[model samples]
Target: MYKKLAIMALCCLCFTDCSQASRSVSCQVITITDGDSLTCLLKNKKPLHVRLADIDAPEKNQPFGNKAKQFLAKLVYQKSVQLRILGNDPYQRTLAVVYNAQHENININMVKSGMAWAYTRYNRDPMYLNAQKQAMKARLGLWQDAHPIPPEQWRRKKRK
Candidate 1:
């Protein structure tokens, strides 16, 4: 009887997870709040907060911060985009990849354009990393600054 009860509980848990996974929805970019945050208008008649997956940008007060925000804004602000929701972040924001109106991947474009850096710690996309490396090699955007501080390290310094 105990074994049957355990199996039933496991099945219930699996079903719940599957249901949650199916809740993924898409959206179009209404604004780019920052490098990692944006506002997307969803089909459900709600505006969603989108946090980019696997990367974090400099804080607003940090060096090159505004530039990053501007770059992202130019790419997607007020532009139609396709968002592939990954899941909800700890802050209840939707973590997603935002593609352009043309169906091109925006994240990869940011990296390729030297507007953003590849977050090697969490992102395993080799193409993104490679693009960033190429940009760095060409001394583009933030890379052009001889003493540009990394966003992660800037955060650490601020916490002190």
Candidate 2:
């Protein structure tokens, strides 16, 4: 009985807000705001805005933008995911590495499948780099466009 009580206490602690740092949480994808941003319902917590770490997808008004959102939706909408939280972004979205039920790395998959970029300025993982290279070489998804503008560039252009 003492062991069971200790385990219960630990579980309770894990679910609290103070334990969010570097913690993993099981969540249900509530909304895919864009290709790289989503909202999820974390267990016993408020809805969390999540930014896919180490990748950037086209903006909604950019080339292949809707397609990127669609692709991400297909992969995660209403599905349970495990978020390995790294930290928070400037916009307060939880910056995380998301894994699906089958344990696939959703960020790398987005890059490999050509729906997103490796976001090289912030990420140097070989897996992400190789995925981008392979996707470009294969001319998959957005790579089919000979001069696809990055989302960052597209956003800047819009502001001008």
Candidate 3:
């Protein structure tokens, strides 16, 4: 029992001290899978899948789905971006706030442009919330619809 406890403590210490490890990666986008997801090639690592944190864009087949993907592609496709790793979601995609080489926050920009919804489930940033409000008030992008269905709800309905 004592040996097991010591081993566990060592493991905890090893994992906790990750300051030497990089939490962010600079990569070139290899593909835009969807509005909220993309694959990028890091310098020495395999292609990484990233899910935009704090936003949910429409899925293909849903309203404005293609437009959302297009918008994302225009913003980041073939561009270098910095991924601030925020860990992974249940789906195993790395959740990150992607910033373009210009330092523009692509995740928040998606919300501001009305191409994505502020994912309140995993975020409570006032900037994102405010951006959604402005987009909705201005009837921008997907907000042009009389009743834009949230991607999550749309997915649930499809599953049922």
Write down the lDDT of every candidate, Cα atoms only: 0.74, 0.88, 0.89
lDDT of 2 by residue, 1-160 (tens): 9997786576454342234556799999999989999999988868999999899999998888999999999999999999998767667678889999999999899999999999987778999999999999999989999998888888989999
Q: Please say which candidate is ahead in TM-score: 1 or 3.
A: 3
RMSD of model 1, in Å?
5.4
lDDT per residue as tens, model 1, 26-124: 666787777778998888869988877656666678766788889899888877777776566657677677788688888777777766778776678
Tell me the tens digit of each residue's lDDT in model 3 across 51-119.
998899999999999999999999999999999877666676777899998899999999999999999
Backbone clash count for every predicted candidate, in the order shown:
0, 0, 0
Candidate 3 lands at a TM-score of: 0.86
Better candidate number, 1 or 2, judged by TM-score = 2
lDDT of 2 at 134: 99
Q: Report RMSD (Å) for each prediction in the order shown.
A: 5.4, 8.0, 5.5
> Which of the two candidates, 1 or 2, achieves a greater lDDT against the reference?
2
